[model samples]
Target: MVSAELLKILVCPSCKGDLEYDVNADTLTCMGKHCPECGMPVNRDGKCADKECGKISKNFVGLRYRVEDDIPIMLIYEAEKIPLAG
Candidate 1:
């Protein structure tokens, strides 16, 4: 389990967004949507939602980081991008 103090300073490496920690699961999830290609949260559907970019995806994706020994990995390369299932 991650300590509250350590969890407070953690954020997503990719989007710099807030991360939700699950103590029992020992995992941290990025709350923001991100484009798998651009590495940016440009769209609500995990694509470049920008009008100019005009990229869209049916899949919604976000990142998940694992916490080991109360320390978060916080590595973008190591982070897993999981497709959100509705």
Candidate 2:
């Protein structure tokens, strides 16, 4: 588990968005807009933040990052795509 101080300071590295920590799964999820083309979080420019993606689209999805040994694996490429309910 991450320390309260650390959790308070932690944010999504990709979009600089808020993250919700899951205690049982030991993961952090960013409920920000992400590119649907490549599933990478989008930046303020409306393009996929990841260099590999870089897709310019309005469609987006949510992403989840795993935590190992209390350290969040916040890499955009490694994040799992999740559906956002309308």
Candidate 3:
């Protein structure tokens, strides 16, 4: 996983747009609406928004990463795309 610092600087590879952070999941995310940019999400309860978008990884690609610990599971390959429940 890239450091919070690096994640802050990272952008969506597909669109070169800004990525939003999911603090609870400790992950970086960029979930676009139908446009896949100018991101606008309607937050819900007890579920992760960006995480679900990442499951499909339908938008962002070519995810590069930097690890902070021996955990060594920061790669996008490790991130499975899923859908966010409203």
Give the lDDT of residue 70 in candidate 1.
71
lDDT for 52 in candidate 1 is 54
| Candidate 2 structure quality by residue, lDDT tens digits, 31-64 | 8898876666677777877797679876577789
Rank by TM-score, highest first. 2, 1, 3
Shift in Å, residue 10, candidate 2: 0.8
TM-score of each: 0.70, 0.76, 0.36
Those runs of model 2 whose alpha carbons end farther than 4 Å from true positions after fitting are 43-59
Q: What does the lDDT read for residue 80 in candidate 2? A: 90
Ten contiguous residues with the weakest lDDT in model 2: 36-45
- How high is the CA lDDT of each candidate model? 0.74, 0.80, 0.40
Off by over 4 Å in 3: 33-86
Q: Residue 67 lDDT in model 3? A: 33
Higher-lDDT candidate of 1 and 3: 1
Query: RMSD in Å for candidate 2, one decimal?
Result: 2.5
Q: TM-score of model 3 relative to the true fold? A: 0.36
